[model samples]
Target: MNGPGKIYNTINKCRICGADSIVDLINYGEQPLANSLKKHRDDVEQKIPLTLSFCKQSNHVQLKETVNKELLFSDYIWVTGTAASTKRFAKEFAQRVIQITNLQSHELVIEVASNDGTFLVPFKELGFSNVLGVDPAENLKTAALQNGIETITAFWNKNVSEEIIKKRGRAKVVMARNVLPHVSQIFDVVEGIRCALQDDGVAIIEFHNAGTILNELHYDSVYHEHLYYFSINSICYLFEKYSLYPFHADPSPISGGGYVLYLSATRKNKSKSLLQFMEQEESNKVNSHESWNRFAERCVEHKRLSREIIDKYYGRRVIGFGASARSSTYLNYCEFNSGNIEAVIDNNPMKQGQFTPGSSIPIISMEGGLRRKPDIIFILAWNFRHEIINLCRSKGYRGDFIVSFPFEPKVIQS
Candidate 1:
């Protein structure tokens, strides 16, 4: 069974704009902690309550409760700069900052939630006198230090922001990439940025756009860790609240499905470009509740078709690729059990020997894919489908691949 009843709530006021005008959007029923992987001997596990709600006033999607931060951030398994494309993005972003700001060699650049210092190293190589990374993950911070990147293992809250301001002064440029959505109290995170930034400094925050997620039917992105799903309209409202401004937005296909955002705090005078984009999005009905409801329906249909397709052909030899956090929702919501999926194969050695949190499906190495030689491989980590397909090909596994999102299951010949 896919859990019990759905968790519902009523929001009279918007979290972003604080307006009394609010309406219900599509709700993704109760879900467990997506990233909570199980260890061999560790039996203790916490199943936090989770639900998704949308604010009609500002079009901001948010989780109903404030889940524990430790479960998401501390001892985090996922690193920001691990993927090849993300590393390229980090390096390119650093170069662009230097070019746009005309930063002097002595100017300082800081990044919050700078996992493993992947982005900072590029700035360091550019001969920037000061470059600092602040992240709460102690292990990752130590790893960054080992890689010759200066890092402070502390959460970037108001207190930490004040300390940094006093010791290092305001940073010339601050970057928080893919970190905003994980925050429970978004206002506090924005305040921290304001404190750490110089008067003329600009802060760039990148997040997964809510419009893309809904329109593309990216239900996998819905996890307990991600507290907010931001659209340009919602983000604009959020920025205004914190005395910050969103001057620009450049949609890109960077993070798997799509990412459409580039916000700056320096421009007090709002750009017509941003307004035009917002208006265009509104015209397209991107913020309407009806759109999300329809999209949610599509997601359900896709899940049904995928289950049917897999059941028709494979019988019992199907296995999943990518034991990712998103796979948790897919498995739990679709009522998939260990019987349907023989095992999960992952490239990360840390997770290879462990089991999935909710489903308890054993995670094995990529070698297992070859050993089992299943007829079809259900790609649970659909975001990295291209990379995974290439990897399986390199490993000499010629099985068909399955994608269970956007539309019901479809097989891609490799």
Candidate 2:
């Protein structure tokens, strides 16, 4: 899998267990990188097969192919501080971590994939001076530095972890939020987490829950960058392989819905909430093949229904709200383009002037979109539906809104 210029490779075995037990769950056909917004509408984009699969051996759900890490993350555009919701969550996350770990003010706290240092800022504000960030994006690292948070610009691996140990000693707290699923080298990253933490330190790993993905029909979250859709069982298997065991699990509001697992080198009694979470997953058969098959069927049906609803307003002015990565998957899967959508409105200025991948719809500022006098504002980022709707109304948008999720598309009168 190592090469100087290699782009991507198809996987025949499970990324976590290296077993020839991969089975296709859903194929999204050929799709572009979700975050690769184009500067020009006519610019040629690369499209690859984006399929989700399940590992019979490890019970891990992952993509059928691995896009090069550099290509996906090197010049990342997504930032954590852009959304108000994320900022609010950051404070809560910091408080929760401090309380759960009984973290000291002077102890080292390292966050992997710490985009723009938004999460780490709260720790520093809470009297923790030994906060650090590690991310692969140079541009984002610069942003983090400007925010007074020191960040190392490199991917998380055993070598990087060892270097950190030599420089600052092992961290008392290591948190990787929404990053475990994006790594193709699953074992390497987990080993890195094991090596980076102190023997008694808490390692918090947060990821999109595979159970929620199955039960909530959040197939729009499936993209090239996300290599694994991890179940709690699968994550425990990966961590326990390196002698790190989870003792607690709690729900996170990020990425629609997620789980934060607290692990340490020493084995400890599992929390009641963690046990309940696992039991519920087992009772619902979320990890079963039958559930996956049903989910795939629902995805197909949802796609059809979504397209049908959008087609009803084909000739009208339709602007998509929120140029999110998930929206990229949803819009491209629905075969939307400039003809179907006038322009996507996004708050992030980095994406406003760009065009969406595969779909080729221009991204615009909210004010620019409102100036167009659109008849319908399609809510593509349905996870923040209420917030987006309220923001639009506050900005004086009197148009109807459409939200697609949880089965079918619904239209709300202005």
Candidate 3:
């Protein structure tokens, strides 16, 4: 049900439950595609409605409007290897899976949305011959292949899963990191997992936690690309339908504290730790309408505070650090264009010389931008606050370095 020129799609029913009963959350209004970097200054940015909604039946949180996959993928440039923290996490994550699952080299491990084959590369290094990566990004797939990572350049769906099973047999483990929300058909993804995995197989998925997003008022996390936000409740309800059960789960600090869930075809027993985590969520008011309403009020105030801070340093050369996807949402929401942000400094060369999707802020090399001696360095990629702040201080940029997250902008002392 798609065409080449299709711009977007709308979901009236709940993404997880397939129910007509749903509740409207906050509307961030029309937003440009977050990862749609501007190659030409004259190219027009595509805009779409960025509204969030919650389901009464399933307690799932998701975006009402979904940006087409073609716009975000195809020639995707966001690489996992580009981020230092993620690179470290990928190695550790691969090792952890090996230790817990006791995965043998002969058993296949398939990673969906494996950007630049970052995680799979570690598996290959560890002597895992049966490792494969599936992604829709052509440029990234090419890079992975050149680097000796075997990859299937396609989106992971039931058809793709069947194709993989026919070629390589069922996977012992299927992995998707920080990619669940970006998927439009939530059920298709989980169903594909069911089809692709062996009887004793496991599926590890990590997604942005709705509780953290609501409690911390991280409104900037919302964008057109992020189709669905998840909580433990939402994840369980969605997976259980396809006979996949979450036997274990933990919290992740990246992406504003995500939930790392380990699911399998068979549940050996009800995990006590998992039960306790669910209890914690219930006490945290994850399902209550009041909790989200409170979050909505805070989002309004946070936006006001961020604008005031930008206005305070009016006429000062304010360049942003970390031209990340998260930064795109925040910059656009706050209306920080070239007039406000001098230029965004990024470590990734792929992003350099390109403009941010909405703000149209030019992405430049970190060293080049720091040498310009901007008065204030606003850290949009606040997740790498420590690393970025240290880099700036080491370069002798005697200016205010601000971190925005967990609260308003706080100036990090030198």
Model number with the top lDDT: 2
lDDT of each: 0.74, 0.90, 0.83
lDDT score, residue 209, model 2? 93
Between prediction 1 and prediction 3, which has the larger TM-score?
A: 3
Please, what's the RMSD in Å of model 3?
1.9
lDDT, candidate 3, 6-102, per-residue tens: 7877777888778987778788767888888899766887688778787777777778877777777888777778767887887888888887667
Backbone clash total for model 2 is 0
Q: Could you estimate the TM-score for every candidate?
A: 0.89, 0.98, 0.95
* Whole-structure CA lDDT of model 1: 0.74
* Angstrom error at residue 287, model 2: 0.9
Count of residue pairs whose backbone atoms collide, per candidate: 1, 0, 0
Off by over 4 Å in 1: 1-13, 19-27, 41-44, 257-280, 313-316
- Rate residue 83 of model 3 by lDDT: 68
Q: Write the per-residue lDDT of candidate 1 for residues 17-85, one digit (tens) a residue.
A: 777765544455556677778886245665555566666656667765556576577887776655566
Worst 10 residues of 2 by lDDT: 1-10
TM-score of 2: 0.98
* TM-score ranking from best candidate downward: 2, 3, 1
